[model samples]
Target: MKTHRLVQNFSGYRALICALPERSTEALAPTLKKLGLQSELIGHSPAAPVVLPFENINADRDILFIDGDMTLPMDWRCLRGAGRSALPPAPVVGLVGIEAPSRLKALLLLGATAFLAKPVYGGAVYSALFLGVNEYNRKEILVDAVDVLYEKRRRRAVVIKAVVSLMNIRNIDEDVAYDLLRKESMRARLSIEDYCEYMLGLRQEQDKNENAHGERQALKG
Candidate 1:
């Protein structure tokens, strides 16, 4: 929901070119400069010498140009977020020299949002950047949505437990107990999950106090 409905304007964004030959990125520079992007070329084999590590890639300001022909310091695919991270950290445009299936597969694994042929065209640069950046943004939105859904699912059990406790303590039906909790949560300006957690914690503290009181009473007797 935080995503801007409009496609992002690329003025002042950094273009990180990952390739061995400086000539590889030669054609890309002027075109990007025209669009207000600052181009930084990385020609090192290990990629550590020229620029920041791929792990530090920021989706908001960084756009990557990965050359399929170049020797990668690390697996470019590793740059794409997976497992706990659903979306890639930045938009990637692949500069593909080889047409082999294996090479293309590597690019796909790298989560390239778009592709350009071996000879980068000045005319095609804008389109590729547009698609790549917007595609990354789209996936980021999905990742955030998934995270929210996961948190809600995890808290579902706590909500049920709190509702059941209310039913038992107040001598009411499950429906009525849920209604009370929902209303109280709205009044407290908290999410239902948060309200449930608060109720559960309060109940736990009260139970401990009651147990301590009973133990003291028994000792006195």
Candidate 2:
């Protein structure tokens, strides 16, 4: 999936190229023109509209932003570059000054695709665009990543709630409730929601198919 294809199909300005005081757009103008990029240059503040120009531009076109003020990691910016270069949901690049490994890692984890030192180069900008990665896959990948994170958090809460529920039901100590939850989890071989629902008899209809599988095995034996 070429990044340009996605951008073209979607509509609007595909790229927003901004630079720091030192970086020169002159270095990359030739390359950008050669590539037939539909891009806008933002020099000083207000040279471009700060607010999203949704009505003016194509609704579906992904925005590729190159802002220097915001600190970010190289990989994070690279990810953005890859996305913008290949598919829709354009990548935004931010510059960072901090050199600490932890800080850099945090920025990368936070989703910076690529980064550059103070003096930005045309080659770096060109590389971010030409290296190209599929942006359409981004939403799907991000959604799944978020889901996994959300589920982990939800599971922790479910454990806490199950323990509390057991304590309430049995008039037992918290430890006892935890023990009950543990046992039930082992027995059901299901996740927290399933475990909780089973305990409360909330998903009996949904479990019928699963129960029938055991019955079939018993008959075969």
Candidate 3:
């Protein structure tokens, strides 16, 4: 149920160019500069394999410009088939030269949200940057939501356990126990699962204290 505003300003973002030194790339740098983005040409050559700076990539601060002309080191087809990470660490804009399906597919696998045609038109740069960055943000938000759903599903057992414990302790029916738990969770300003976990923890501590007190009394007797 969360919403995000699209990022309009791209100032302080770094553009990481992962392409061979060419006229297109040369033209791209100044365009990025005009948009207030600092450009860094990564060392990529046709003779040598392309090495993506994966570790240094930051989703918040960096935007990638990958050459669609070059053959990337990793097998995109196999990676996608194997269910490896489809999304790159940063937002990517494909520097597309060849209009072939194979080349475009490679960019898609690399998670390119936008494309700039070869020979780099300065006018299209801003549009490409805006689309790429915002699209990446949107995907990230979706991924986070999926993770939260998975976590909540995993904690369902804990919630059930807490409900059972409450029913036994209070001599109440399942529905009443569940309703009580829901109300308490709202009062505590926590999700039902989280509040149930907290209540269980408190019960555990109380049991430990009671056991210790019983032991002390038996020692005196």
lDDT of 3 by residue, 1-221 (tens): 33666888889999988887888667789988988999887655556755566677788899988888866464444312223434677888998998999889878977889999998889989999999999988877887687689799999998999999999999999999999999999999999999999999999999999999999999999
At residue 130, candidate 1 shows an lDDT of 89
* Better lDDT candidate (2, 3): 3
lDDT of 2 by residue, 38-148 (tens): 666544454433333334443244444454443322323223223322322344444445566765665454344555443446556555543222333354456556667
Off by over 4 Å in 1: 22-24, 45-56, 75-78, 82-85
- Each model's C-alpha lDDT? 0.82, 0.51, 0.83
Candidate 3: 10-residue stretch with minimal lDDT: 76-85
- In candidate 1 the C-alpha lDDT for residue 73 amounts to 59
Q: By TM-score, who's the top model here?
A: 1
- Which residue pairs collide, candidate 3? none
Per residue, candidate 1 scores C-alpha lDDT tens digits across 39-136 of 88776656454444667667789998888887655544456556756555678898988889998888877778899887887898888998988887
Q: For model 3, what is the error of residue 163's alpha carbon versus the real structure, in angstroms, after optimal superposition?
A: 0.7
Best by lDDT: 3
Error of 2 at 46 (Å): 6.8
lDDT of 2 at 7: 29
Clashing pairs in 1: none
